[model samples]
Target: MFLRLSPRHGSRLLTRIYSAVAARRCPSCSAPLPTALPTCPSCSHIEPLPSTLSYHDIFGLPSVPNPFCVNTQTLKARFLQAQKICHPDAWSGKGKKEHDIAAAQSALLNKAYQTLLSPLQRANYILAQQGLSESETDRLGDTELIMEVMEAREELEEATSGEAVELARQRNRDRINRTQKILEKLIGERRWDDAKKAAVELKYWETIENAVKDLE
Candidate 1:
């Protein structure tokens, strides 16, 4: 008989394997890390760790968010491991300075995790990391895309019946999905201007989605 694993079980197994593989060692004694434990298991040296690493460095991921590939299982595994190491509560027994550092590192890790988890946020983060801002994003000059957004908003506003509203919502969902694909391609190609435009379009669609949800 063959054993079968469900998707959830498979993801959990992958996460554990990835976490174990990506675990960081103590700088002092080089003991294998189980989580982001504050002290070296072998040397018992209490030192601030993981605070010095960047978000991508902490996760063992590439510096840039890869548009073509994202392993959420790996990301989650890394996040959990980092949290274990950096959560302020984990450092409470140490010193005030160490506790404060842990708190700050935890905050940064949370921000990075949330940003990378959502496609829209991930795109915006990538653009922002490349020095693109909302004001800069508006200058993409895609008149047709702008017009389509305006038309969609108009249609949503004019929609009255339940069926009409549902139809409008579905249309907006389709537009959102299409724009997301464009955004991914633009980001993958390092086209900042076009990606920013796509990101802005996504924001509009998200607003429309919220409004439709409110109506329902």
Candidate 2:
């Protein structure tokens, strides 16, 4: 029979296992890297960020935890710390080659931070890891839900007053929050199919939010 692991224990075990893999040699000086992170703390060398590293790994977080559970304050601090070391401007005088590496490293970090910071994007990323990309998410089958969103969009088009826009925003926000909770449960349970559906629902809500604009 296969062994069963408690979620907490499993997370710790996975973190340790991944951390070992994450620590790599700095290609320049052969120094051990804390992660595949672009900067080498030992030699002040900057390397290209590896695509194989997960966004969570870049920030030294356990990859198995709910992606949305990351601490905002902690993530921000880690991002700032990484940026200070590998931002393109930091390597401007080093050499064109090093500066190019730093530029790519900085771009990757920004993408990772932005992905981890947004709940919808985080869900999409996690799902993508399971081979269920957002683009591949099956079309949502909830007819009534589709109708509700369509109605909301139509209402938004005619919305003239600040109060009306604020109300619409609140409704969209609530819908997004509920979908997030559903995603958390489905993902934590490893129900990839259902989690993908929830993520698709979230994407619709986010798109609607983007259409909301300042009242003229």
Candidate 3:
């Protein structure tokens, strides 16, 4: 278990789960790294960023008990701040190596921000961390769920008017919102199986939502 809380008592007890995470440091200045972000806040050194860092870790967000609940304001603020330091524009006229590293960092940071900002992407990311591949997320086996998505698609295709499209669009939006809530709870409880299924459900809903946009 990554983390388990005590039920009978308020106190917590951790079992034998040894983790030895190395301290991140700036090579040039040897300053303690505050976040897993690509650049050092103290010395403006661009360290090699680890791909293993969770999206939460990149932004310095809490990654325990309830990583699904994100404060968007906090995430946005941090993302913009990080981008200012590492954006390729800021690195121009510097050495090619510095510019290249900054460009890479900027790209990775942008991808991380978009993934966490979207509900479906965030849920799928958690499942990926728990041993599911990005491709496997769409291979849903729930017959009922498949049928529901098919029917929704058919209804949208059959929509002949803007009003009809809006109606179908609203229906899909509602479904997506509901699935987001389910994902939040299942992920918080570490119910990986249920969470994976819900992530797939959300994926279908998101596809429909996009299709709705095309219709409009």
Residue 215 in model 1: lDDT:
86
Summing lDDT over every window of 10 consecutive residues in candidate 1, give the lowest-scoring window. Answer: 45-54
Which stretch of 10 consecutive residues in model 3 shows the poorest summed lDDT? 11-20
Which regions in candidate 3 have their CA more than 4 angstroms from the true location? 1-43
Better of 1 and 2 by lDDT: 2
Best by lDDT: 2
- TM-scores of the candidates are 0.71, 0.79, 0.79
Candidate 1 colliding pairs: 36-85
Model 1 lDDT vs. the true structure?
0.70
**Cα-based RMSD of the predictions, in order?**
10.8, 5.5, 6.7
Using lDDT, rank the candidates from best to worst: 2, 3, 1
Candidate 3 per-residue lDDT, tens place, 1-216, comes to: 555556522221211110112335556677875554546657667755654556787777777878888888999998997788788888786778988999998898999999888888887787887886457435668888888899999999999999999999999989999999999999999999889888888888998999988876
For residues 27-115, what per-residue lDDT tens digits would candidate 2 score against the true structure? 67878765547478677787565445678888886566566567767788888888887888888888899889988878888999999
| lDDT string, candidate 1, 1-216, tens digits | 966889766665654444345355666677776553343435534444333343444466664455424566888997887687677897788778877877776777788787777777777767776788656335325688778878888998999899999999999999889988888788888888778878888888888898899988
Position 73, candidate 2: lDDT: 77
- State which candidate, 1 or 3, has the greater TM-score: 3
